[model samples]
Target: MHHALAFLALSQLKGFGPARLNLLLQQCEPDGDDFYADCLRYLPQIPGLNAQQVQLCCQRIHNPFHGEWKERDQLLHWLAYDQHQVLTLGHADYPELLQQIADPPLMLYLAGNAELLHQPQLAIVGSRKPTIEGFNDARRFAGALSELGWCITSGLAEGIDAAAHQGCLQANGKTLAVLGTGIDRVYPRSNQPLYEQIYYQGLLISEFPLGTAPRGHNFPKRNRIVAGLSVGVLVVEAALKSGSLISARLACESGREVFAIPGSIHQAQYKGCHQLIKQGAKLTETIQDIHEELAHWLQLPESYSSSSFGLTTDSSHFSSNGLLSAKDSLPAVGAFSTAKNQQAVASNQSLELFTGHSHSADPSSSNMASTPDAYNPNLTAVAIKQKAPSVPKFDNPQQEQLWQAIAQGAGNLDALVMATGFNTGEISQNLLMLELSGRVVQEAGIYRVNLSV
Candidate 1:
């Protein structure tokens, strides 16, 4: 208890982030019956610490109990609950992967299953304002990956992060939610139910002191922990400037695999993913793609086999140079043909844990609500029965006419608009929908039929 208090005191010191704290600890080597006495004696002589840092350390050591004991008290109160723990750096239960990061949290406040800290984790992150398709993809991927015995980790933010957590839980799999605020606080109050579920069934982790409110800057700092705790980080969808992209960059810097899902070229939401792919991040289409990359790190169950999931190990999806092929075909059209079908697949594929939900920033009926009947398990299989589109089909005569015009000689958007007599918006929307549905491909402002579709 005394040692814990001393460590807590050091953690409370101003301006002493993990990196500087670690360096100071190494230099001072504070030890003995009176740890504060040792700190006061040795901290001043530490070579790398600036004068202000040394002064802060001196002040902390001189009056260790000066400030509020609220943080320590709250930690103790929380610890009295079942399965709650505090994992300090170098502790036996501290995760080795996190410890390897450049600036690992000095301590983590953990609730629920502590053993899960040692389990393999894959981080899933993306835009807080994800598209409906992006939300479903996150849930589906998380569910499938969790079934393989991998724990899913994410910041307890909305959108893709929430979907990933719920998906894992639906599979009766473990998950971890790292927080930007205190462990006791759940940001975006809408996720209160999810917060409780994870606290009891999986784990809730935070580096923030008890009662810390959610701050904008804390999330980027929080992103590092999300990446640090996992073997890899999977970005489902994100804009060019997003916290998800920050996590991906941090994952790469830490020597962890970074995976991204491609989205329609027309959507600004997908630009970050395209950028990541261009920067050498792996482009993942299916759970099998991720499984192939992390197979060595995973411990499969006795019943687990490649054949169980009908996963193909062939690398044809990727180029000979190991990157995703530039000419790689888009996802099958059946995956995104209708909103109903997308909802069915998202719900049934992941067992309805996060069915028909959207956490977009601008929440509205159009973006957040889905058909109430879409949760039927058989509906997903039925919806996918349609043969993959070999030749793109359009229900609207205008879209069909526009597509035919493009297929013939009118390849550019302007030419298509002129040939079909449709307005520019109509042509652009049709082209985008076709590209998203895997029937059309756009290159250099020219549209072409996807022959491989």
Candidate 2:
């Protein structure tokens, strides 16, 4: 790595942040040997990136931050810290668009194939609680864009974000996943598989350092990176109250094209897209529109010619390793399943986990209501809140008794399970079955009886 890359890597540490480090690094020669020696004099002028933090970073180095011993040691240790790579703004590997942004990340932590960064890319963003159709749209658009040589970029979130990555991968395209957490952590835990896939195929990037976990504030920070990496962005589906719209607006501020796919007049998800269309977002329906809009930069025919490429839809989806395997073994496309029922699951931890029901909530039903019939419909994120867990089954007498205890609120599930004196296997199986039957509800990590008759 170059000196700038090393300096930037050290700067990614806990206290040696980009903005402050940039200001500090400028005080010394960009290629000077005395850079570390000059550090102590400049330490007094820096703010936000405290001296102690610098001391911590320098300590690992032999010389340390020149009398800011701790700073030097920490910087040294930071310099030694591996696993992540740092790309400077002027580096050939740095994305030119990102460097031009209002606040480009001085040091980028990239964990995938660097070549993906070279491809022209489009941003695809939408609600974390997108509908199945919304997910399908994101995937299809991303896949199509990928085929057009556009790398896909998005926040590594659930719903629309994952859908976009999955789509690009299905088309055997490149992608980039920016996260709100450290490269080591995957938020929502359920997205682990998707995260792994993207890390292996596309690129995983973050402005945050190696150990940062998700904070509510970290996400908005991440959104900027998504907008910065792409030439334009498309909003597939989002509600008026969604963050994807925030990203789309950011893309606009960055001088990138903003496009939205219109939805039904009656859908809440459509509102954000419609609002953007009115705000001058290009209304897009097909990949051709995006390719056409970006023609000068993306380069291509005004319209796709059969000679440019024929649309070939086969079972050529990629498996875990980022390669298209045999046609017969591909898993079903994310679009085949409707999110209408997906809301019925969440956390992947819930024995009765329901993201939302397969059907939308009655909206007319009270919080404590139960299904008049054993079968209630699916739910929607309508992302942060989770539905009550499902009661999987009540077929056995011992299991039924434990279920009764859980529903009646005799105690929490753990306590009831203990009191009812049931084995964990039987208990979990019964609970999951009850959830699937819609007879029980789990929420706030607690299980309750659906009381409304």
Candidate 3:
């Protein structure tokens, strides 16, 4: 308790950030015969201890331990609760991965299963205002990954982060929520249920001290911890200027794998992911892609090692570029296979060629002659049924206007924004609705009216 008090005092001292405190601790090794007194005695000798820092340390050492009794008592009371504890930097239980970062927190206030801190974690993050499809993708990926025994780590924000947590929990898997605010307080207030779920089932971790409010700046600093604790980060959907990208960059800098799901190039939500893929981040379409990339770190069970979720481990399916080979013919299944075929074709072609009608078979082609559709009535029916659905009516004037603009050759987000006189956010929301409703199609950065309409 005494040592904790001294450490707490050092943490509160101005100008004593993690780097400086680490340096001071290395020099003095504040232990034995009244550690605080020893720190006061050798404060001046510490290499980076400026005069102001030295004076601050002296003042803290001179003050009685109970001087800030209320705050100290509060922390003690919090720690007294079951499963609530603090991990200092040098402690054996401290996560080694977090310590490897450039600026590790001096202490972490943890709630729930502390053992999870040692488990391999994969961070999933993205936009707070994700499209419905983006939300579903995050949930599906997180749930699948969790079932494979990897712990999911994320901030407890709304949208993608919340969906990730919910998915992991639904799979009865462990997850961790790294907070920008103090563990005692849940920001956004709306996440109270999620906070409770994580607190009871997984873990809640934060570097911020008790009662720290949710300040804007703290989140970016909090992002480093999210990336640091994970073996890799999966970005579902993030705009160009989002915190998810920051986490991805931090993960890259710390030598962790970065994975991004490619989205429609016309959506601003996917711009950051596109940028990441262009910069060499792994392009992940399915859980297999993630599992393959993190195979060495994941240490899968015998079942998973041989195959994943019943999908055959056909190395031939993947191309030299590490994507699914487009040339491989789709297996004859039912509607599921038809959907998979579309995805496979999308994967193989450039974004510009992903428009559903781009690869129509030519009557003069040799393959058309070899496999006559007239010989297989069932296959012909399936092919005809798999054709793109007709466009639906718009829900409102905004959506109608956006669709009309695209139909009028407003081919990009900026052009649509200009043509419809809608701001980026409004345009994005309407476009997403149109895309989801099959009224519009976007490939590469170009928007096209669904000709099937």
Off by over 4 Å in 1: 27-40, 47-68, 301-305, 314-453
Error of 1 at 436 (Å): 38
Error of 2 at 354 (Å): 30
Which stretch of 10 consecutive residues in model 3 shows the poorest summed lDDT?
A: 348-357
Ranking by lDDT: 3, 1, 2
Q: After superposition, how far is residue 337 of candidate 3 from its true place, in Å?
A: 32
Q: Give the TM-score of candidate 1.
A: 0.67
Highest-TM-score candidate:
3
lDDT of each residue in 1-453, candidate 2, tens digit only: 435434543654565555766677678654567765565567556766656656644442323223533423433355464334556654567888887777777667677787778778888998876665676567656765665567899997877787687667755678899999977688867567777777778788887656677899989888989998899999988899788888888788989999999888899988999999999999976554576678466554353331132222332432342222222121222322344222212101111111121221222332422324332212112110233444444567875676556543322333454457777677677778767766666542334455332
Q: Which pairs clash in model 3?
A: none
- lDDT, residue 343, model 1: 32
**Which is better, 1 or 3, measured by TM-score?**
3
TM of each candidate vs. truth:
0.67, 0.60, 0.68
Best by lDDT: 3
Estimate the overall C-alpha local distance difference test score of candidate 2.
0.62
Q: How far is candidate 2 from the true structure (C-alpha RMSD, Å)?
A: 14.1
